[model samples]
Target: MSSTKVIYALYNDDDVLMDAVKQTRKAHHHIEEVFTPFPVHGLDKAMGLAPTRLAICAFIYGCIGISVATWMMWNIMINDWPQDIGGKPSFSYLQNMPAFVPVMFEMTVFFAAHLMVITFYMRSRLWPFKKAENPDVRTTDDHFLMEVSVSGDEEAMIAFFKNTGAVEVKVIEKH
Candidate 1:
């Protein structure tokens, strides 16, 4: 199998990493990926990544959850077996909506949270028993790694990363 050569720039501080990312973009370098010990605020923006649409998916999931809960409660309390509890009759779902509010809210939150997590994992290509794709162990500890696809002048790319406050730079063949 043919392998692609890429540059990996390691930084010690998140701030420095952020600046390096900005400079790399300014110089028109295409960043492949970035690995960090923790989430870096605005890193995605620096890397020119588009905003995530997970919130929209969460809203849709929440709507589905509430709809399911409403249908289930209506079927159980109103359609299947009508009940007279606390001197209240289950004649109309609208009239009994206040009583079902708790269930609706719980279902909405549950579905939104759970489905959003699943969607995020699926979108990220994360799966059970997946092998780790991290390039360096230090990225999981206290370092940040920036991966850039090399196009021309490997030596100049190394010099550019070093000027951007990278602690170390290496070129490796990525499969």
Candidate 2:
């Protein structure tokens, strides 16, 4: 398999990291990953990442949950059991819908949350309790880090990194 060389730069400032990403793109170097203590808005656009579709998926999943829960409830109470209880009309959903609202809401939230989390994890290449590929742990807590993949002219990439205010840079190798 073909692999690329990557360099990690750690910085304490989020602004500097944002600027660095813009500068790196300006220099036309390909950056592979960015680690930040917290989210920095607009970094995705700066990195040229396409807008995510997870929200759409979440919505669809929520709709599915609602439909299944509603259908199951109606089918069981009206078709399977076919029993009216406590002077309530079980055969008519419009009259008994207040009872199913809680379940429908719960199912919607359940499906949305679980499916959205799964979609996010898959999209981010993350799994439960997975060790990070990043070398520095501080980047997740208090530092911003950028990883750039270098090819052909590494010197130029190094210069570009340094010029963009990278506090520390370390080369990573593939075995």
Which candidate has the highest TM-score of all? 1
In model 1, the worst 10-residue window by lDDT is 86-95
Mind giving the per-residue lDDT tens digits that candidate 1 earns over 94-138?
A: 999999999999999999999999999999999999999999999
Reference-based TM-score of each model:
0.98, 0.88
Cα deviation at 79, candidate 2, in Å, is 1.1
- Per-residue CA lDDT of candidate 2, range 34-153, in tens? 988788999999999999888889899999989989998889887788776888887787788998899999999998999898888897789889987867889878889898887667
Position 11, candidate 1: lDDT? 99
Badly placed stretches (over 4 Å) of model 2 are: 1-3
Candidate 1 segments exceeding 4 Å error: none
Model 1 deviation from the true structure expressed as Cα RMSD, one decimal place? 0.8
